[model samples]
Target: MTARVGVVTFPGSLDDRDAVRAVRIAGAEPVPLWHADADLKGVDAVVLPGGFSYGDYLRCGAIARFAPVMGELVPAARSGALPVLGICNGFQVLCESHLLPGALTRNRSLHFINREQRLRVESAGTAWTGRYTAGEEITVVLKSGEGRYTADAATLDELERSGRVVVRYTGGAPNGSDRDIAGIANEHGNVVGLMPHPEHAVEALTGPSEDGLGFFTSVLAHLAGTVPAGADRSG
Candidate 1:
């Protein structure tokens, strides 16, 4: 069977279609999920695309944390039974839902940033990032206002020690994120959150580079048990 990857669409989701297109381009069936629906439709994986969910009310992803779709996604991802990838605003939602540690704060400059951002893959073991080798650099589109990632000192230390830091800004910290962190994964490597818009980088004709296709392809590789070279599949 073709792997089915669900792309959740929140009320204000701006990149859901792009994410769905990426999934199809990666050779997986893209399933559309709604914020108001509790059922997952039995997808092998899920992608939360970027956008200002709930109008960024009370904080970027604060309100979207309570969406009905999250009710199912939260527990499945927490149990390591599902692979979940959160991008941009979706990354903020995962933090708000506490699936991934830390919070995304406003950029130090307090300005909305939009550009081609360079990042280095720190951990290739996560389900969402297995296609890339560790330390490999890639460029992707990054656009966000509250993309600075912050966590307590202890949590930062643990994330580093456990190899949960999946990616980091390589060109320079555009958002003043702590430790130049751009993305992270959970201890089990089933859930990941990234501040860049990988979905927007999948097509060579329309994006800065096709570097982001790895994220979508990596998930398909994960579902097939054919995880790429650098992946740690122990979990």
Candidate 2:
């Protein structure tokens, strides 16, 4: 059966359609999920696309974190029964929801920065990154003001020890994130949050590269059971 990935559309979301298109390009059905709807529509996985959700009021994703859809997503994701991918503002929501450690703060430049960023795949064990090999470099578009990832030293250490650091900025940390981190996964590896916009880079015709397609493909592989359990590292 073809996998069905839900692309959520919250108020002020700017990349919902792009995410849906990416899913379709990855050979999966794209289901539209509303932020106000608690139902997931039986999607195999979910993608929270980038945007200025809730008008970026009350701080980036702070308010959107409490959306009705998140109420159901939190528990399901925590149980490892569902896979969730958060991109840019979605990453902010994930941090605010406490599904992932660390918060995305203002850029060191204190301005909205937009660029094509290079990231090294640090962990491929996660549901969203399984298609990538460790050390693989991929380019994705990034646009945000509060994109620096920060966490307590202890938490950062723990994430590193547990192989939860899924991706890191290559060459330099454009947003000044701790340890040059750009993405991370939950303990169960079912939930991932990243500052870059993979959905925007899935198509070669419209993006810097097709490297971002791996993320969507990885989830499909996981749902198909082609990805082995504990098969976390890709050298």
Report, for every candidate in turn, its global Cα lDDT versus the true structure.
0.91, 0.91
Candidate 1 residue spans exceeding 4 A from truth: 228-235
Candidate 1 per-residue C-alpha lDDT over 125-225 given as tens digits, one digit per residue, 9 for 90 to 100: 98988888888899999899999999999999999988899989996789999999999988788899999988998888999999999999998888888
- TM-score, candidate 2, is 0.97
TM-score of each: 0.96, 0.97
How displaced is residue 229 in candidate 1, in Å? 12
Determine which window of 10 residues in candidate 2 has minimal summed lDDT: 226-235
Cα lDDT tens digits for candidate 2, 74-112: 999988889999999899999999999989999998988
- Poorly placed runs, candidate 2 (over 4 Å): 228-230, 233-235
Candidate 2: give the clashing pairs: 125-232
Candidate 1 backbone overlaps, count: 0
